[model samples]
Target: MRDSAPLTPPVLPDRPRRAARPLLAAGLGRRDAYLLTLPLAALSLLPSWLGGPPDAFLRVALPALLAVLAGAFVALLLGRWPLERVLMGLLTGLWLGLLGRVAFVLLAPGSAPIDALALCGTWIPVLLAAHVWMLGRAAGRVASQLALGAFVLVLLVCGALHPAFALNTVGNVVMQILLASLVALGGQRSGLLRLRREVREQRLGADLTGLGDSLTGLPDGRAARRWLRQASPRRLEGLAVAVITIDQFHHVEATHGEAFAGCLMAHVARALEGALGDDDTLSRLGPSELAALLRVPDDRAARAACERLRLRVASRPLDGVNVTVSMGIAVYGGEGDGLTLLAGAQDALDDVRDAGGNRARLGEARRTVVEDMTPELRSA
Candidate 1:
């Protein structure tokens, strides 16, 4: 939301940095989105009868409307499509509209359809627009946009000066060639390149290995669940997520140094990792919290993994001391996304957190297996 003119149109990606209110990036290049609303811009004609048309606006508004939508359609859907090529699409589409509007006046109407000046108004707007786009910062990428625009304007001027000297055929053909060239060049630079990077960053963010905590090297529940949501349960066999917490963390900290408690957590993380398969992600969610996203082959296999991890943690020594950890497991894969899985695991964790914290509770497995792992199970 730049303080653009009213209804200037939307273009570009949303501002990724802004959390509360995202703004659309600068530029509106999609065409189908534009053509869809072409009829609406025509209604701008109504204001003409009241206040009179602005200096050559009504003539250009419809063209600009069509151009913007055409540009966006090319960019968003047709990856590898160039903004320059999209600009060409806009140029050709708007120019075609101009030809239609002009032809409508010349060969059809008994009264004057469009005066020569009004006809020139059509090309002028398109040319002026091309010139502006060429001057924008993106212009630095393709030096030829400015040149192409200049060439098209020159040809348009040649046609405007003498109809006998210029035929629409020659101008139309030249415009098409320039547009195609622009598309090949611009589409690669701005369109496809920008799109691929966004996808790559998103994939890496969900990567299981990338997001684990540095100190504990365990994963928080949010990252674990998101990773499981993306992973294939069928391929990995039995995949489950779990939340684990030490009981009465305050008492434990008071009994031992906080440094010793940290050592205990580190020991617990190391033990879980050693106990589970390599395809697991673990993190610390809070002071007393730990989460795990694990993939095994089947339900029985998942249960075995859970049991092995529990036994290992229980049997392990931390600073030559033993501290029990309660665990809650939630199976993930195609079951649901985000909170549906996480909340189930959290509910189970809360149950273990409450019922003395030395054992593992099954949420997704029981929810799927026993069919009676009710939300009330935790309270019970």
Candidate 2:
């Protein structure tokens, strides 16, 4: 049996976690898509003047109008307009883009009628796809079917006018339908997945919020007690608990109302946590009461820690209202369990309360009363 025993390595825990998805998705919202529109628009307009126009007026006016609409899109997006309002701006840009091409064709002196009509075959479908994408769900499907029907009618007109061009136009229209359908399908799936993820995260956050104080986000009494039981004797060789209660808490709560009192506690909790060391654990024991467990070398170190935390709380303001805290500190390793030590700290707090708070007291025993000591003696 002794020979059979062999050495084994200890199992280590996994590393810190990362987000499930760090990369941005292929489908972009209004915010991300708007950023790329200006550059794309610029490129599209760069060659507008290459071919001479039928009239100089059309050449000058069309690009300028499109530029103005681009600026409007940027303004609407930055101003945080509602979704429906922003959609209006986007649709306006597309409509202006279509009109710009029409003006260019009309102003050209040698342009044929079929050449002018070809612009519809090219630009109208694009506008319809944008409409489909923006509308989404039932509205999008209706828009898609309507667009398909309109394209078929346009194809019939082109066949009667120019049979040779109509064959190629049919292929182009078919390709547009397939491409738009694929993009819409992908975007819809990505949006649904994003919604599911957001719902799940909200539920998890709500559960975690329930396990802690709503205002301070500090672990409540139940979690605090469980942590103490696990750490007091096993993890921390020397443990000292300091119970800090806000001075005149009941009166403050009455004067300011519950909402204001909760806000004040949250500010105080942040200050207290910032002043603490890595080895110290802070929790909200109750309304207006905070509990801190300090891992220190001796009783002197614990009191010093308590004084630092008390001063930090006293110096801070709760929304322009000055506040102070009284601490009752009890050290372990002298005698008793974690709960007994917590009781001793509470008993010492009673003495501090009796002496008109804004001070601290040391716990010698469960029923023992220690004389008042100044901040100097308490720290030493």
Candidate 3:
């Protein structure tokens, strides 16, 4: 028995996996980084005020004040401008400020060669590392990687040009690179986790609200009712609600199977959805009924739309079986609420079903026939 058993282990089927989220792809809006500029600008001036001449305070103070003011102005433009554009402007301003400092050091009469080189070695790496971290957090992974590579190249060139200080410069460069890599990885992981949490929360909210029908993939009745309740009176004006029911759906289901009935319902949903305008909303209201919220100019337009839907459904053949629908429309007169309008449409649907099926009716002073029953027509 043991010799007859298979030598290899059985291969199990692979389970479908969710797509992995891209690292550092979360959007960083203006609100996340707007306040960072003010503090960073103030801190950039600290070294200048501490080590420079007595008049250095006046020289650095004006530029720092200007930078803070510019950051403030950018903050005011947050909602008007795109976040990426705003971040680009801020990064440009920072680089320009660093270049100005480099020029100041180079032009000073008493400054030694070592002092200028030291300034570059210290501040260049600091500024580049800060930028790398910021870009990782705000811009994205590509930008952060680009900055990281550029800074490494610059450091390598500096080390080659100055052989005497190469040891210390190379060490500093290594430490900075490690620090930057760690910071970027940590920030990206945190951002990915936050994004995942937000997505899960949104899915939960949707499930709780029952806003979508799992079978038909259309908005469910709850969503339709919610929209009706939330819509303003001005918006509700000239709007119409039409309830559509699959004629003799129970009999069809009994004749066919439940699975076929479900497929038929989905087919009818697609047909009704295709006939609707861009502004109209289609929803599944029951097992065999769907509802449409149409934005029409008048009752005549609403009736025409319902008639078109009726014709569209009857014209299509699903699995060689003829299908027909009954529709009831209730136009909003700027008086009652959304639920009331839905109730009126439901009442009209009952009337249409009572007097034969395969027609459209308008809910008004009297149940008005928008389309007459035509049982002689068959789907091709």
Candidate 4:
């Protein structure tokens, strides 16, 4: 016997939101950052070609261009491998280091080589900040802190070795670091907001579609149709659809109130569902009709299943009233679609109602002999 408790609609659990990480907050993905390198590198070198001597410019520009091209080729080869991001970061660091050295040489030609090297070291902090903004904070935080420590060390060394040059450039270096920090923070916040909005929209869409039937707590006709459309050909083999209609459902509603009729229908749905196998699906197609999709070996098995369902419904009493269901079964013969099969089942159900209303009828070219049901057999 089935459980006597009333059926309740399924409640979907709240989906846990992922904590926003600093790494994912950055809108720029690894691939986008890698692809943007070429254009940015070209723009950075424009100053050297426009203002510096051609011989000195080529010495730096040619090597940097070759390195950029080689890095791009390697990144493309790696595709989506995890190591690709690490390789790209290394390549960017090398390129920035080269540019820093060139900048010190061109801007402070007469300064001592050691002083120029100290100034060039300032590029490390800038590179770290750029990394945080482009890829993510988690990827670059450790390196950024180390670079900052190195920057402070360089500042102290320059102060001891060449106090005048250190004093002159300290303000400029501090300003550059501050600017990079601001940019990184802004990018993270913006990306986080966009990510949150996208998650909310996805949750809303899922909630809208996941609700099934309100009364019987079973899937409705729409869900049944969707399942039929999505089911594969292998699964459809030997599949049969049975449409069950309660006999004199309108008279039951008229005699008892509408509320009692609704309760009776829910009870019938549960009884029918309990009779079906776990592999089969039962859905409420209308107020008086429910549809079952069954996997049977042949017409005999399908007929037996429908008869079992009919007996199960008639055996139970709802609010002191006996109920009996008439079923129509149609099997898939590998020719027509789900809609056609459903229509055939409905046609068979009409035939069952026409010939007294309690027995199950098989609909197809090879129809099974249906036994006649006398007025004494049907429910009141």
Q: Best-fitting candidate, measured by lDDT? A: 3
Query: What's model 4's overall lDDT?
Result: 0.65
Query: Each prediction's Cα RMSD?
Result: 22.2, 15.7, 20.8, 20.4
| Candidate with the greatest TM-score versus the true structure | 2
Ranking by TM-score: 2, 3, 4, 1
Query: Which runs in model 4 stand beyond 4 Å of their true positions?
Result: 1-211, 368-380
TM-score of each: 0.40, 0.48, 0.44, 0.42
lDDT of each residue in 1-380, candidate 4, tens digit only:
01011122357999999877674465766565665565575465555456445354356655666566556646655675564465555545554554445344434445344434343444544565565554555655555555545545544554555556534554355445545645554565567657755543343222223436778866778877776776667767888999999998999999998999999899999899788775677778899999998888876677777877888888898878999888888888786777778788888888888877887877854353222323232211
Task: Please list the residue runs of candidate 1 whose C-alpha ends up more than 4 Å from where it truly belongs after superposition.
Answer: 1-206, 219-222, 225-237, 364-380
Weakest 10 consecutive residues, lDDT, candidate 3? 1-10
lDDT of each: 0.55, 0.63, 0.66, 0.65
Clashing pairs in 4: none
lDDT, model 4, position 4: 11
Q: Model 1 misses residue 355 by how many Å?
A: 2.3
Q: What is the lDDT, from 0 to 100, of the residue 129 in candidate 4?
A: 57
* Per-residue C-alpha lDDT of model 1 across residues 186-206, encoded as one tens digit per residue: 554565456645543443334
lDDT of 2: 0.63
Ranking by lDDT: 3, 4, 2, 1
